[model samples]
Every structure is written in C-alpha cells, then in structure tokens.
Target chain A: MKFDIGVILASGHEILSGLALTVLIWIAGSALGLGLGFIVATLRRYGGPLVNLGLAIPVEILRGTPFLVQIFLLYFGGPFIGLSLDPIPAGLLGLTVYGAAYYSEIFRAGYQSVPEGHVEAADCLGFGRIQTIRHVLLPEMALIVLPPAVNMTVILLKETALLSLITVPELTLTVQAIGSQKYAFLESLFVLALVYWALVEIAGQLGRLAEGYFSRYRTART
Target chain B: MSWKLFSLLLQASGMTILVSAFAIVAGLIIAIALSALRLSGNRLALGFVAVFVSFFRGVPLLVQLLLLFNLLPALGISLSSLSTALIGLTLCTAAYQTENLRGGFAAVPPGLIESADMLGFTPVQSFLRIKVPIALRLTFPTLISEAILILKASSLVSVVGVIELTKMASNLAASTFMPVELYAAAGLIYLAINQVVTLIGRFAEGRLPGTGVPAR
Candidate 1:
C-alpha cells in the first residue's frame, strides 16, 4: 500500500519525537565524549606509561570494534552490574565512552598542533596553561579542527539508528514500528529513509555554511 | 550456539570482505575518472560531480542501504539484501573517494605534469605518470581509514538480517544470553582485523611510489 495521509501525520509526529531522541543522543554523547577525550589527551600529554597504555587501549578498542556489539553489551549487561537501565541512557553511555576515545585523539591533535612559537610568545607575555588554551591555542586550532569534528558529529548523528535494536524508539524505530503495524514494510521504510536523507542533507548544507562563515572571520566555535 | 551458526558467521566474513573490497576497488576506479574530469574547466562536469557527491555523502549509509534493499524491490527491481548493501556502500564510497582523489590531484605538482607534457606525453599519460602516482600515495592513508571505517560500519548491516559478525554475535547473545562475553569477543575480532589492516597500510606506505601520508 502507498502512504496514507493519516499514517503520514501520525508517523511524522512519532518521527519528530524520534528525531529529538536521536539529536539528544548525538549532543549528550558527543559532549561527554569530548570531555572524556580532553582528560585523556591531557593525561597522556602530562603523565607517563600507565596513562599511555590506558589511553591507547581504549582508543583501539573503541575505534576497531563494531558499535553494534557495544550497544548489545550495554543493553544486556546492565542487569548483572546491579544497574537496571533502559536502552536510551545505556546506549548513550556506551556511545559517549566509545566516541570519547576517538575524540581524545582529535583533541590531542589540536593541542599538539599549537605552534611552539605561539606558546612561547604567550609565555613571554605571562600567560598560563589555561589562558594559553583559551586565548592563543584554541583560537588558532579551531579552524583546523572544526571541519573534522563536525564531520565526526555528522557520522555520530547517523549512527543513532543502531540504537533501535535496543528499543530506543528513535526515528528508525518509529518507522519500523509503523511498518510492522501497517504491513507496508518497504514503503514505510522508504519514507523513514527519506526523512533521514532530508535531515542529513540539511546538516551538510549547514556545515558548508559554517565552514564558509568560519573561513571569513574565524572566531566562533562551529 | 551451534557449529552451524559459527560456520555461517565464518562464511559471512567472506561477504563482508567481498563487499568492502569491491567498494574500495570501485572507488579507486571511479575516482580516477572523476579526477580527470575535474582537471578540465567544464562547468557541467563539475556541477554533475558535485551533485553526485552531495547526494550520496549527505545521506546516511543505513538509509541508502534500505532504499536500495527494500524500496527497489517494491518498484519491481529486485536485488538481494547483500547486493543492495554492496551497491549502497560502493556508491557512497566512490563519492567520498572522489573528494579525496581531488585533494590528491592538487597534491601533484603542476611542474611534473608540465615536464611530462614537454616529453610528448598525452594528457592521459601525464595523469597516469605525474598526477595519479603522487595523488594515490598522498591519499593512501585516507583510503585505508575509509576502508577500516567501512568494515566496522558494516556491522550495522546485520540489523537488516545480513548474517555477518555482528549478526553472529547477536544470535549468540540472544540464544545463550551471554551478552558481555559474546559482544566482547566479537569486538576483539574486529579490533584484530583493524590492527592487521593498519599494519598493512604502514608497510605499503614505505613501498608505494609517489604516495604516502605526509608527516607533519
């Protein structure tokens, strides 16, 4: 069957809510990931072997492993750890931890790319570590870093579909639910896919706009 | 749970490799053409290429796979889920590879091409000898990373019932309810595969002429 108007309206409402959940996961997980990555980057930069091994292993594990399994462990392993949790939060936690390991490297790259001359100049002017990052370092590095970081964030947004297996009721989940109910699996799936297509297309356009904007003045955090 | 499932998963590993390898191979071929077209100042060629890249790169892979796998069947253009997955991945990979290869194009010094031209080399010969070699070398690491990302990301295909490593792990998880152990074991397998790929990439970098990840 083709898409019914009533179904469209109802499914659109559900998908909007699902999109909210997807965005929530993307923002919360990325923020947490960035924070964790910052700490890891700083520790590895400052500390020795213990920190090195600790940072390296997680990065490998997170980057190399299938995110599906990570989600599975969080969804099913929750009960054994004396923490009964739902799919959304558990999935968010796992993704955040995993994404953090990758983000740590990006942070490390940005931090290291700070020209020694710039740092020395800041030091010559009596600037400290935090002040150096805030004033001299991040301001310059943001241009180099924003493009890649935004690209990763776009990848993260699309990845939210994987959480449907754990029953998060995200966009894919809502669409799949409608398909099962209506027995119009292919059409419903197509509609949902188009919804995602439109959303991501908008994101790409925004990234381009931001890149162009940053290319002009280069102050704002994209 | 059984040896049968293990064998199925083992067999599916071949499909995963086949899909990813096809994507990489096709990406390289298509991107070589795109890079040539980009070398010319043809607005129509540039615009068409731009649109192609934008559409594929803008959408999520899962959606693309679904559109091909499910939607086409409805339109009476039937294909297996596995074929659909491969096509979707190849299409998307080719688009991004074009983008990277364009960067590779810029990496090739114009002087080298000019020297080739002075030596009576055709445009094609100049591209093959002077442009492509350096571009491929300059772009190898990006290609390697893309392949690795594709491999890990292919795990998402199991959701549509494609019976790969992730599907095997999921089945075992559901059957024996060994969530953590099974998933951990599966994750390690992927890590091992990725490690091997990374090693191969580094080794190849030292050998491939006019190509390499530039050290900063």
Candidate 2:
C-alpha cells in the first residue's frame, strides 16, 4: 500500500519507452502546431474578411473547449465522420490542432508587436514584402514570440498525457498498465510524476537560456 | 437524442461550473497565502514553496488526479472522485495563481512602500491598505482568464467518473450514436461559458484601477 520505489525500478524500461513516445508525440505535434499557427496568423493579419472569419471560428472553438474533449472529438468522434485514424495519428492531429489555436494568438501578438516604423524603414530600403518580413520582421518577432512560445510548448508537453485516454502508449498509459498488472499504483504514479517533473524542469531551463539569448539583442540595441 | 438528453447535458454543466467555481475560489485563497510566504524572505519557506510550485505546475493535472485517486485509497483516505478532482484542480491552479500574484506584488513600487513607512504605517497596515488592493487590481484580469481555463479543464473530472458536461456528452453520444450533434452541442456550451467569462472579465477590467492588456 505504501509507495514502493522498487517496483518502479523494476519496470524502468517500460516507463522509459513510454517517455520516449511522449517526447516524440510532443515534438511532432508542436512543430506542426507552430507551422500551422504561423500560416493562420499571417492569413488573419493580411487576408480578406471571409478568410479571416473562416479561420477565426475554428480557432475560437478549439481554444474554448478542453483539450480532453478535443481528443475525444477527434479520436472517438472521428470514425463517425469517416476519418478512421489510428491512435497515434489521431492524438498527434488533436494536439497539433488544439495547440495551433493558442499558438496562433501568440504569433498574432508577436506579429503585431513589430513596430510600424520598422516596416516603413524596410520599405525605404527598397526591400520587397517577402524580403522585409525575412529581414525586418522575423528577427524582432522571434524575440517577442520566444517566451510565450516556449510556455506553450511546455503546455503541449503536459497535454500529451491526455493522449493516454485515447490508448496512446504514452507515459501515463504505460504507468496505468503497469499499475493494473502489478497492483503497484502508488509506485507507478509516483514515477510518472517524477518523469514529468524532470521534463518540465529541463524545458524551463532551456526556455530561460533562449530568453536570455534573445534579450541580448535588445540590450545591444539600447 | 432527445430533449431529455439536452436537459441532462445542461444539468451536468451545472456540476462542471460548481466544481470549477469551488476550485478557483479555493485555489485563490491558498495562492494568496503561498505568494505571501514567497515574499516573506524566509529561505526555508521559499524553498518549500518552490518545490511545491514546481511539482504542481510541472505535472499534468490528469496524472495528479490519477495519483490522488489511487494513492488516497491505498492510504485509507477514500475520497470521492469529485473530491479528488477538486483537490487536483485546486493545487494546480494555486501554483499558477501564486506566480501571477507574486508578479503583481513585485510590480508594486518600492517607493510607495517607503512612503508608507515614512507615514508611520506598519508593514501589515501598508500591505492591507495599499499593497493588496493594487495587486488585486493588477491581477484581476489574469485571475478571470485563469478561472476560464479552469472551467474548461474541469472537463477532465469526467475521467474520474463524475458526470460533468463533457462526460454527459460522451455518454449520450455512445448510447444514441449521436457523436457529432452531441459533441458539437458540448463544444458550443463550452464556447458560451468562455465567451461569458471573457465579457465579464473585460467589464470588470473597465472598472478596475490598473492598466489592462497591452494594445497593439
């Protein structure tokens, strides 16, 4: 009944494999989410009204619902809509789409944060639109976006835990399987918590390093 | 499936709101104390709080709920699913709100505190009369946003077998083979609740004395 660290040590390989899958899903989903968000933010900023409205409704709906519910809709409800996807793909799609909604907002904020004067300056330098975005906007936007984007990626990492319910062989699911088999619920869950804590700590340290690196540009400018 | 199902989802949504409201209020009260401790300049207390925040913030709420649900029974605690859900949510949100409140406290100008000292005000009196109000004003909008997030996150409670709105929708969908309609309705309900929260947050922001979200 008391937590048994020995049980966790015995099943270390199983837990580590689960952690690997979790990291894989997280990295893949987040990359897709960021790319999708970049496009959506750009479109929302520069596209016509219909395009804006078309993207806005889905983003709003995704943002408003819980990620668990979104997973259910995609995993359980997908078959009903003729989507017939496997758990891994379904989970990745759900995480990516859900993350995109939040990422789009962060990207939009970063896009808007670029000063108007900078764009005008780029224009005076005879920079084309694409050239201006590459030369003038992206560098500044990276500084503005890095902090929140890192936070969102951490959130996305935690969210991958929800995929366990959809039968993804992720950390939580793996732990639950071990617990049920060995009746080592305490040990398994405790190990699960530690794994996540370590991950988030590593992510936090990396985020701080990135923030410090990006802010150096501001200090140099001033 | 029927009007009865629609009404059932509505009734379950009441449970969702109840759980979220309880968790948010409980989280806020505990976070205030935690933030105070964080600002107290006691090394041991600060270290304790740092570990507490890191554990709660780092781990997923789903795992926390599972751990509490399983571990409590083993220890003879025997909490209900709803209680387990509430405890998980309260602890998790407390960590986040504590950080936000700490930021608010740090933003309080030291000059103002110095002047309060010059005016013969005690630390407690200055904190109560000046610091608390200003910090609350600065943090009110974020508090509302956190509340909204907690409301949506409360859907996770369904996993522990509480028949909250999301669970109700899944139940109806399974029983009646109406996944699309039911899930869409559930999504709409969530959207409506969040929209209302956002509107109320904006309205409250207009009345508060501090600056709000930055403009473009």
Error of 2 at B74 (Å): 2.6
User: Which portions of model 1 miss their true places by more than 4 Å?
Assistant: A1-10, A117-128, A208-222, B1-14, B36-44, B111-130, B211-216
* Per-model DockQ against the true two-chain complex: 0.56, 0.77
Q: Which lDDT tens digits does candidate 2 get at residues A81-131?
A: 899889999999999999999999999898898889889999999999789
True contacts kept of 2: 0.73
Q: Which candidate's lDDT is highest?
A: 2
Query: lDDT of each prediction vs. the true structure?
Result: 0.77, 0.88
What's the CA error at residue A69 for candidate 1, in Å? 2.2
TM-score for each model: 0.86, 0.95
Candidate 2 per-residue C-alpha lDDT over B1-216 given as tens digits, one digit per residue, 9 for 90 to 100: 578988888899999989999999999889878877887789999998999899999999989888888878888887788888889899999998888788788778888889999999998888877777777777887899899989988988888898999999999989998887788788888888889889988998887665332321
Clashes of 1: 2
